[model samples]
Target: MDPTGNVGLLKCIYNIWKKPSKKAIIIYRWAKKMHDKNYKHIPIFLTNKLVVNYGSFISLNANIGRNLDFRHINGIVIGDGVTIANNVVIYQQVTLGGKNLGDFQKGNYPSIEDGVTIFAGAKIIGNITVGANSIVGANSVVINDVPANSVVAGIPAKVVKKLSY
Candidate 1:
């Protein structure tokens, strides 16, 4: 079989075998693939298992792009309708979720663009867009939109510095 065609399958198997800290991503990928293929029940079962095993709760409805890397996988919660682009790295205890308890407003979850890095203990809530190549510091609370190529830190996450291309 062609390697590129089976990349996801291969990666999932390998990650599970290696038992990496971010093995949950591979599991999520498999669940997402099953979900996309209309294999609903299996995905739900697998995701629930992953939540219990990995301590990472990723919604089946979350839209994620390729090459997502996790530094520490514990306590990572990604809510429904949240969008994460390619080459994004997320650390432990990060929450990308909505503001309210009940049903989320349309487009109310956080959108993480390409090349974004979210540090440990960061809580990115509400309908906000974290731009490409930006860095969210540890323990920061992001309630507003972050500009591209910027480094944000502290409570409410102010732009500490703008990165150059």
Candidate 2:
């Protein structure tokens, strides 16, 4: 029947079958929708348990945009108060979290702008902004704000190259 070629429900189901990451994200989206509508309990379970079963921990409190792509579903953590924009690709073992776990204050999370790609095992901590079209290299520890259209790497990441376009 070529479900992948079909539109609407068929395509969605095909994607869920083909991609593990998509399956997890779909569950997250469903839970997030319920959370936004003030339907508690279920959303919490869905996010904490079901998503965790897939090996990802994405807080429902985080603000996320469209076209969020998780290349590898496992070992990804998106902390509360974090903001992620459209078309962001996050690989496995990537953590977008606060620097201080002791500080339970609001707005301590990082903000990821559109078209950002965070590679595997990268830890982006604190209340910094990862600008649009930026790429964070694998195993990098980013503490400072990244400018738009830049490529960063290494511990406490620094701009390695400035991208054009």
Candidate 3:
């Protein structure tokens, strides 16, 4: 909470993200463990944290890379066998889980690549793959496979923007 405008806060945030502090990693692991215990509570606590602020009640088995940046920890559920790359930013109310939770199956999870940014209230299920540098908008429900450097939105997550970087 900075006294200045949003830009200053964003800049400060960027700086911290550029080089994640030891405290941040520690907190992230702590949050991960907390998430393991209670995915519901982790988001609320994570949102307040300067580091990783995420949500949901799930057993995330993703390969989360280093220097993660969780913007606004919301109602996110990361299931087992999922993978998250570096510099990935996940917003509130997102779900990353298996398609069939009741039917247990190995190696069936979502894979989120590097430099990805998932907006608030998005739901990603099944054995889908979110390409690198992709963006999933708020409240979008993703069930299909998203291309690299693309922006997906809407009820079923349609690609709206194609990132050229």
Candidate with the greatest TM-score versus the true structure: 2
- Mind giving the per-residue lDDT tens digits that candidate 1 earns over 1-165? 675769888877776668655567777889999999999698999889878887889998999999898888888999997999999999999999999874355778999999999999999999999999999999999999999999999998999999999
Task: Sort by TM-score, best first.
Answer: 2, 1, 3
TM-score for candidate 2, please give it.
Answer: 0.90
User: What are the clash counts of all predictions, listed in order?
Assistant: 0, 0, 10
How many clashes show up in model 2?
Answer: 0
Clashes of 1: 0
> In model 1, which regions exceed 4 Å deviation?
1-16, 102-105
**TM-score of each prediction:** 0.87, 0.90, 0.67
RMSD of each: 4.0, 2.7, 8.0
For model 3, where is the 10-residue window of minimal lDDT? 51-60
Query: Cα deviation of 47 in candidate 2 (Å)?
Result: 1.2
**Tens digits of per-residue lDDT for model 2 on 23-128?**
7888889999999999989998888775557778998888999999999988999988889999999999999998787433757889999999999999999889
Question: How big is the positional error of residue 46 in model 3, measured in Å on the Cα after superposition?
Answer: 12
Between which residue pairs do clashes occur in model 1? none
Worst 10 residues of 2 by lDDT: 99-108
In model 2, the runs with Cα more than 4 Å from the true position are: 1-12, 102-104
